[model samples]
Target: MVDLSQYLPILLFLGVALVLSSAFVFLPMIAARFTGAHKPTAEKLTEYECGFPAFEDSRSQFDVRFYLVAILFIIFDLEAAFLYPWAVSVFKLGWLAWGSMMVFIAELALGLVYAWKKGALEWE
Candidate 1:
């Protein structure tokens, strides 16, 4: 047979949370329904960008080089993030971690060199 005591608190907590949230929503909905507020207009519903009039054909294109640089920045930034946790446990990981990180650094260095050779880092 399942123990009812173990689940009692959890059930109570869930019940109370449900009741509290329901009360919160019920009060706001009741108030709003009775307010009889003015009907919304186009100015209220239309999308506004800092009070500028909406433009047609919002589709826009960006430079490919901009995307390439953004992707490369994210990749290298994530690599640095991994280094932090590994560094914290460096003593426990010892030489194996050191060698692994060395390999990783070498790979990144090679990538940097490749980007340099490909003119990916150049502005012009």
Candidate 2:
């Protein structure tokens, strides 16, 4: 028989994690039931954190500008994320890496100018 002792710790760890997670999730539910706070009313069911119920259908179309802004934000955010690592390693990587990073920045600037001229930055 294959020695199963080596797997005992992993199995025990998973079993404990399962029990703890179950208690954490269900304990609040059980406490609420006994604390007279389990009541669910129509208004509570319909409530929103924004203090206003949703007016439009859930599947209504979003504005094109919303997508444009999101894409631009993600692009620039990724550029910043990459820039930090390149900055840290540029000396070790020599002049080629520095030149490539400069080109990347130039391309980002060109994209920004294009978006600005095309009125992608405008709202309404």
Candidate achieving the largest TM-score = 2
Tens-place lDDT digits, model 1, residues 1-124: 8878999999999999999999998988777668955457898777766687655656777778788788789879989998999999999989999999999989998998898798787776
| C-alpha lDDT (0 to 100) for residue 99 of candidate 1 | 95
lDDT digits (tens) for residues 1-124 of candidate 2: 8999999999999999999999999999999999999999998798578788788888999999999999999999999999999999999999999999999999999999999999999998
Candidate 1 residue spans exceeding 4 A from truth:
1-40, 45-57
lDDT of 2 at 78: 98
Error of 1 at 51 (Å): 5.1
RMSD in Å for model 2: 5.4
At residue 79, candidate 1 shows an lDDT of 91
RMSD (Å) per prediction: 6.9, 5.4
lDDT of 1 at 90: 90
> How many residue pairs clash per model?
0, 0
